[model samples]
Target chain A: MPYINIQITREGASREQKAQLIRGATDLVVQVLGKNPATTFVVIEEVDTDHWGIAGETVTVLRERARQGGAQ
Target chain B: MPYINIQITREGASREQKAQLIRGATDLVVQVLGKNPATTFVVIEEVDTDHWGIAGETVTVLRERARQGGAQ
Candidate 1:
């Protein structure tokens, strides 16, 4: 069984989107890795922007900076 | 760099417990895999019982059956 974990920032994605992601991930694993869809597991994790980090800065700060730069 | 994803049923885990899991996972990767803690990513996902499946049955149904068996 192959386990896939998809992490994304908690930006209010709908349940339908999550279901689509789960289906897409499982399909990819089955197609590329030749895994059985029945045994494959796909987990979707939504992390808060404040908790997800990039380059020693959190996504919250990074997004804010990007917004400011774009506005300037 | 190592990425660790821990999946568990949504059973009302506290923030401290999640933090402990993240720290413990990071430490394990550093010790066992000799991975850089800075580059290591640990994500904890709490899934609804209705979503997680085993033996073609969801955890919600499985737990209910177990509880019924225990009561009999």
Candidate 2:
């Protein structure tokens, strides 16, 4: 069984979008790797802005800086 | 930051169980990979038995067979 996990910054993702992602990911794995769709699993995780970071700065801080037009 | 995703066959996992899993996984990643817990993300996904399969048999079928004492 092939398991695919998708992580995104906490925001709003409609249920339909999640369904599309799951379907597309499963199809891609089946097409590329010949995995069975019945056994393939797709999971989506939403990471909180405070818990997600890049360049050693949490997303919360980065967003705030961006909003204030501060230097990167 | 390290992201950990755990997949399990859905049955009955309490919120407390999931919390412990998240905490333990984060700690393990920090100790082994030296990842920062503040940015580390741990997510758990529960897959339906029908959606999880091994050896071409779905977990649902396997469980039913086991309950009936059938050959694996």
Candidate 3:
């Protein structure tokens, strides 16, 4: 069984969005890896801004940059 | 890359314990499937008692019963 764990840096994703993400991710794994969807498990972890750091910048900082269309 | 997602019904396991569990679990997976540990990603989700329900009982209830030596 292949288990795929995805960490979403932003929390507060609704249940419906979560469901779609799970399905889409599972499908992607199946298509790319040819793994059986039944035995493969997909786990999603909603992360807070404090839990993630990229390039010495926090998620909050990244979001701010994105909002200002910095290097999109 | 094989990702192993582990869901623990009870939360609050220390970092050391989590490390041990992840190592042991990865070893088990390697022993059983001959997979490389380096490429295997192990993610552990510590579930709150309220998030888990088993056999009409919550994890809290199960822990309470287990403490009294109900079952081994």
Candidate 4:
């Protein structure tokens, strides 16, 4: 069984969107690796902005800075 | 930055348990790879038993069979 995990910023997706992601990811794995869809697992996690960081700044801070037109 | 995603069967852990897992995973990545904790991301996803399978059987089915003492 192949397990796929997807992470996105908090409140970034709707339930329907997440379902689509799970289905698409599973289909891709099955197409490429010949894995059984019934045996494949897909997990989607929504992370709080403060708990996710890039370039040493949390996503919360990055979004705030971007809103104010701050330099990247 | 190192990103870690942890998956577990749904309803199998508590909030505190997940926090511990996040901290431990982040610390291990930092210690082994010299990754910065500020930029490290950890996401934990709890998948429904129906969504997780092994050996062509869903975890829900497996648990049910085990409860009845059925052959694996």
For TM-score, the strongest prediction is 1
Highest DockQ: which candidate? Answer: 4
Off by over 4 Å in 2: A1-72, B70-72
lDDT string, candidate 1, A1-72, tens digits: 887767789988876666667667777877888888788776666789999999999999989998888642
Find the 10 residues in a row with the least total lDDT in model 3 chain B.
B50-59
Candidate 1 ranges with C-alpha deviation above 4 Å = B1-6, B11-45, B49-72
Off by over 4 Å in 4: A1-6, A11-72, B70-72
Tell me how far candidate 1 lies from the true structure as C-alpha RMSD in angstroms: 7.5
> Model 4: DockQ against the native?
0.13
Q: What are the C-alpha RMSDs, in order, of all predicted structures?
A: 7.5, 9.5, 8.7, 8.8
- TM-score of each candidate structure, all chains considered together: 0.55, 0.54, 0.48, 0.55
Model 3, A1-72: lDDT tens digits are: 566666777657765565565667667767888877766655566678877899998888887888998774
* Clashing residue pair totals per candidate (backbone < 3 A): 0, 0, 0, 0
Question: Candidate order by TM-score, highest to lowest?
Answer: 1, 4, 2, 3
- Report the lDDT of model 1 for residue A56: 100
Error of 3 at A39 (Å): 0.8
Please provide, for model 4 over A1-72, each residue's C-alpha lDDT reduced to its tens digit, 9 standing for 90 to 100: 999988788956888999999999999999999999999999986887655545444566668988899776
Chain B, candidate 3: TM-score: 0.71
Question: Candidate 1's residue-wise lDDT over B1-72, tens digit each?
Answer: 998888898978999999999999999989998999999999887897655544334556658998888652
| Global local distance difference test of model 4 | 0.79
